[model samples]
Target: MDRRTLLTSSLAGMAAAAASAPETRAQAGGSGPPPFAETMAEMTWQEADAAAKSGASVLWAFGVIEQHGPHLPLGTDVYIPSAVLRRARQILAERGHQAVILPAFYWGINQVSGAFPGSVEVQPATMIALMADVLSSVKKQGFARVFCTSGHGDALHNKTIFDGVTAGRAASGIDAAVLFNAPLVKRLGLDTASPAVLGFEVAESPARFIDVHAGDPETSAMLHIHPELVRKDLLPTLKSTDYGPADLAEWRKGQEAARAKTPLGYFGDPASADASRGAARLEGQAKAMAEVILARVGGK
Candidate 1:
């Protein structure tokens, strides 16, 4: 059998066995949420197999450790998307879909901020190889479907991730979908105008597309998710900075050659961030992504 066919057949058998056998319960009892282990780190081989057999979709959280101004933690990008994934898992399970949230991927291409402290940069080629290997292993283990959710938004970072998905397919016939969570929020028309979840639009609370990093959206998110990590004193004094390049290529060259332009290493109006608005942003993103996953790969 071809790789996909073989994997699908194996999954079918496992599902059948799982149906007849007593359910392998997570640590939690009722329908509150899947065990912490099921959604986060420390998942064992048995847990993974059981989840896959139970028709659960594995969700991979992808993010990077990089500079996010002097005020925010270097892991702002990682933390934001991870919060979304955690909430997304709950949303999915509530909707009758079993979803496993994996650990976040820390190493990513930091072309713009590599010169700064606390930024860990991985080359495009290396990232592609690592992603391919990861997908290959997931398929080999028994999962027929996978989804990658990301918070980082550099041009090279996105290209590397999608290329890794393509490479995984070419190298091992692994089928998966990746969603850059921030862009997905915008693309789904959730970024602007009024949203159903909240009484008002969160557009004002987040940074504009051009001023993505350490901006209102991220700062607000951090304020809501991990208030302790945020430097409340700096919010009053921080100002907005724009990345004024016409295109991604120009962005890479300009930022690298002139690091002094963004001495604080942040953009957008963080002063306007609010905890309630940040919570709304998280729900909007999670709900939109959940719909996409259900429509695209939930049956598979």
Candidate 2:
């Protein structure tokens, strides 16, 4: 069988093993959220080699140091995805799973907010090559599984990263995959071993009338995950920069048009954000991410 096919066929057994694992979430219970210390940057070579030899999985949360409607931090994309992965890490620990969280990759393609002052972007080829190289190196280090995810929503950002992932897997023959944003997962026809599609579902998400960028969904998330980064005074003033097909086309045109379209670099109603809702969505996304990892690593 092909590698993908072999991986698919073994999913059922993996889930069963996870379900019957000795450590239960209840037994692993604690107050507040978890503090993930299994960071690749912090680990010594010997420690990393041991985890790889033990068949541990890993995470790479790609982010963008870009604008978020002038009200959020430049690292909003970085913070949110990294936070989700941290929560996912906690869940995996509860299930007797172990995985290292790689250092945040912040230099990603930024089309939507490119025209804004704080938005940082790079060539598509750079991102693609980076993805391939990273995966290849992960395999060389002996890791058999890895999940690449991000909170950024630019269409090209999604396309380029997936392209990189495919190229990386083909060249290195590694087991690297992505827990892509919900829209791209469906768009690319990718599916996970888990029953639920692990991507972030845009349509059914916490976003209201329109919540793509610094709108309710993202704003509320920051409020819960990193409230200090949010500009409380600005939340009351931000308005909806609603998105549709036309808006998407404009965004894709380039940074100039994107800047013209949303001068403040926002695209949703941040005014409607709620901290409580933010907390719930963070946990929800974390649970889904954890499920994806569990199914991938539990079987072995």
- Each prediction's Cα lDDT score? 0.70, 0.77
Cα lDDT tens digits for candidate 1, 1-300 = 999999999999998997888432232233322224345456777887898777777787777889888778787777787888888888887888888876777799888877788899888899889988988887787777677777887767766766776787677776676665444445434322221111112233332445566778788888888776777788889876655545333445535642566677775567777888788989988877787676655432
Measured with C-alpha atoms, the lDDT of residue 211 in candidate 1 is 58
Q: Write the per-residue lDDT of candidate 2 for residues 194-260, one digit (tens) a residue.
A: 3323464433553334557788889999888777667777788777776776776776676888788
Error of 1 at 246 (Å): 5.7
In TM-score terms, candidate 1 sits at 0.75
What are the models' TM-scores? 0.75, 0.79
- The 10-residue segment with the lowest total lDDT in model 1: 193-202
Task: Work out candidate 1's RMSD over C-alphas.
Answer: 16.0
What is the clash count of model 2? 1
Clashing pairs in 1: 206-217
